[model samples]
Target: MDLHEVCDLIVDCEHKTAPTQAEGYPSIRTPNIGRGYFLLDGVNRVSEETYRSWTRRAEPKPGDLIMAREAPVGNVAMVPAGLRPCLGQRTLLIRPMRSKVFPRYLAYLLIGDQIQNIIHAMTNGVTVPHLNMKDVRSLPLPPLPPLPTQRKIAAILSAYDDLIENNLRRIKILEEMAQNLYREWFVKFRFPGWEKARFVDSPLGKIPEEWEVTTINKVTSYINRGVTPKYDASASSLVVNQKCIRDRKLNLSLARQHKSRVMDDKYVVFGDILINSTGVGTLGRVAQVYEDLNDVTVDTHVSIVRPSNGDGIDFLGLALIDLEPHFESLGAGATGQTELRRDRIGETEIVLPPVKMRKQFSEKVTSLRKLVLNLAARNETLRRTRDLLLPKLISGEVDVSELDIAIPEEAA
Candidate 1:
């Protein structure tokens, strides 16, 4: 545990490359919901030309640890496959001084919440924070024992990360299925019926005789835009920022709840869909507030929609997600960060089947949504458990001598 005597491995994480797409440059973005090692913050994918543009881009080797160091700080991910090629912005890449330790072990050290406090100390500027090579060199790290011990800890944590990634992968598949269904049945006008399907006029523009166009307001009477504080309460409300909508799930883990104004049950309720009205490339992303959330409220940047007594609330969530193509087309305007006309939320035009069919769709989607949520929740829990286990095992705090995790061949 005496880390002071050990020489710390250090490298300046690269500034992210330009946003423009180039033939050689493919981008790497933080995975959704901080679910996998691939995620640190919002997703980023850069073209090869742009990846080369960063003055300090560091090519991580396999087993190297990558940490997001600025703007949004302390998100950590590992380079499992070894560094083939990756470019990052405001991140630190630590190449393990293998003579003394395993790179994976060092990665676990950087991720521990306790060590992050140490990492934060090295950033020079508070407003626009950054860490140079010198700063990274000075980063305090605990001296870990041997590779086997380090492997033990890394294994414990990696278990969670691995499971979380699995869940994310599953969700992606399911959501893709849902989206494809939407496109086929709704967009492409493909249905079980036939080639002779008839069209009819309805409230929501022209639609199939069996379909009806409707406004969301008719779906929910209690819906309205979210509340913003007259007085800022950094302590109280983490207004459901657009970032909260990810992985086709709403993550309020980052939402800060502060006290400013009164919040009623009406302001937020379970199954209530919070629509992101603003954010770069996130305009109109809908988050379904599933069970397990406390009394959380969103901000003006998002609009809250509640289903009517007869409407299938969960169905609405699916419908919105399925209609993402439509929402993207409508477009939002923002000078800097993207902002959309949220007031038109209830007014969004949607085509649906007859009342009975709509109800059936709602029920099926609700059931499927619950299954996805449960699986996702389980995945998150597993990943969290593993994340908690990593540092202790890696740091030699919680012993894991009995856990039989094979060391990578190169690591050995």
Candidate 2:
């Protein structure tokens, strides 16, 4: 059956322009759609009044599948319950015919390679490819299994997703705890025995009398950008890009495989800090490598900062977070692409607490950091398992009917 046959309503957002963040309701755009989840952060907002006015014909409801129609073409995410989001331009809302098709089932089908390939072929655009609504509605959908089987498949996939989501939440909490401690001690100067610590003036600002103000160059043993990756289909090495660093975390999803000859010196190792060195909005972003990434290297746009001695990784990350504004100010460009001045970054002065104190702070957060890394690794494994199972289950190649898989109570 064509998608239009199984879907009750297939509509794109109204062509009307959405208001800026200051004057809008929570609006979702192409970038807001991840593989199977909606990324709320950095999503634009539209006025509630405007949303109601434009969505009069078809309002986005919980369980409706939202797919990017342009600038990306096939990314899909389901609207969660209780979100009255205004569908932004270049996005499509799909309401499945509940009796014949489950919403989650349809969402999973859309992301499967078969449907994705069909959508990709029908997409048309010169610089930025897009899917035409007419073409999308006519796109052929594979024959679906019985509703019970559909539910079972969705339940199994969602279980993995739920575990991954739970781990992500825990990782976020752990990260916040570590960062808060860093701020309280290093930024707010509220470390233990703070009452007796004397104050001293430095080039950057007033800091503890015992702290030394130093440039990043003084603490780092080596600093250099990686080579421009030569992408090879057969390559086993992964190359990190600017997009890989988000919210001070490394997202391997953004990394791509490269065929270039391996250079041991160019490899980003555990404890190495990566900084996006080019492009506006992405420049100056930093993330520490907490895991042992084998055969992984970064592209030229990313600068690798290795601590002189092995202990400054956490301190440098926190310092960079605090001095992000300073780094942003040093960005030089006019064509919407800003490049960070490497010299300025090296010369950026930061307050350095005593070695013993820094070590103490690291020890305090060491377990928290370990937890974050462990959770991230677990999520990666879960993701691989889901991806491996998805196509087989969706294509009916693997039958779950006889399997003794138990669905979570909430999911059931």
Candidate 3:
């Protein structure tokens, strides 16, 4: 069956103009649509009046599938219940014929390898690839099973996604808790026994009298960027790039395979801090390695920062994050692409609290970080399991009708 036949409506957003940030209703764009999920943050907005005007014919509702039509073609995500977002440019809205096809089932099918390959083949453009609505409507779709079987398949797939989502929520909470603690101890100067603590003027403004303002180079033993190796799809080691660092967290999904053999020192380890040292919007972003990320190397655009005393990894990461604006300001460029020199970053000053206090802070956040790591690891496993199962289930290669798996309340 053609995709257009199964869908009640297939429409892209009429408003092709970029929306201003933080000023109006949430505008769903290509960036906001992940593979089978929506990224809640970082989406731009348009005025409510604009949204109402633009969405009169293509109003997005819960259960509708949103797909990227350009930039990165074919990536899809389902609109969650209660979200009344207006679509942004280069995004397509897909409303499934509920009587003929389950929305979640259609969404899963769209993400399967078969449909994605079709999308890739149909996409057009050399510089900025895009899909034509005419081609998108005529794309082939596999024969869907009966409604009950479709529901079963969706239920099975959604279980893994639900657990992953739950873990992500927990990870966010843990991160916020750690950040708040950092703010309390360092930013607000509200550490224990602070009533009697004295203050001293420092280059970074007034800090605790006992604290020392030190350059970044003083506390780091090793600092260097990795080389851009020739890429090999079958390589063992993954190469981390600037995109790997997002929202102060390391997203390994963006990392690609290392092309050639590299030195042991080039490999990332636990306690190492990574900085995106080049590019316009990506420069100065920092992320810390919490575990010995196995067989991973960073690209030239990313600089690795290791502490001198082999301690204070947590403190250094948080401090760098707090001072990100300063580093960003140091970025120099003639063209739009900015670059942060190693020397400038090395000379950047940061408040150094007492060694005991820094150690205490690290120890305090150990459990929270451990939880985050475990949850992240679990999500990775869940993602792998889902990927393996998705194509088979959606293509009817594996029969799930006979299997009696209870649908979780969340899926219900």
Candidate whose lDDT is highest: 3
State the C-alpha lDDT per candidate. 0.61, 0.83, 0.86
Candidate 1 per-residue lDDT, tens place, 72-157, comes to 56656556653344545455555666667766566567667667666676554577665455555656666567767766665656
Report RMSD (Å) for each prediction in the order shown: 4.1, 2.6, 2.1
The better-scoring model by lDDT among 2 and 3 is: 3
Residue by residue across 1-412, what tens digits does model 3's lDDT show? Answer: 8999988999977856755657777888887888899886667878878888879878988889888988668989898877778888898889999889989989999989999988887764456778878878888998889988888999999989999999999999999889889989988989887889999888878999999999999999888888777888898779999989978889998899866677888888888888988977788888888887788989899988888775588888888877777877888987567898888989988788998998999889889988998999999999999999999998888998788877544321
Which residue runs does candidate 2 get wrong by more than 4 Å?
22-24, 124-127, 261-264, 401-412
Report model 1's TM-score to 2 decimal places: 0.82
Candidate 2 clashing pairs, residues 3+ apart or interchain = 24-46, 24-47, 25-46, 25-47
Reference-based TM-score of each model? 0.82, 0.91, 0.94
Give the higher-TM-score candidate: 1 or 2: 2
Model 3, position 70, has a per-residue lDDT of 80
Candidate that beats the other on TM-score, 2 or 3, i.e. the better one: 3
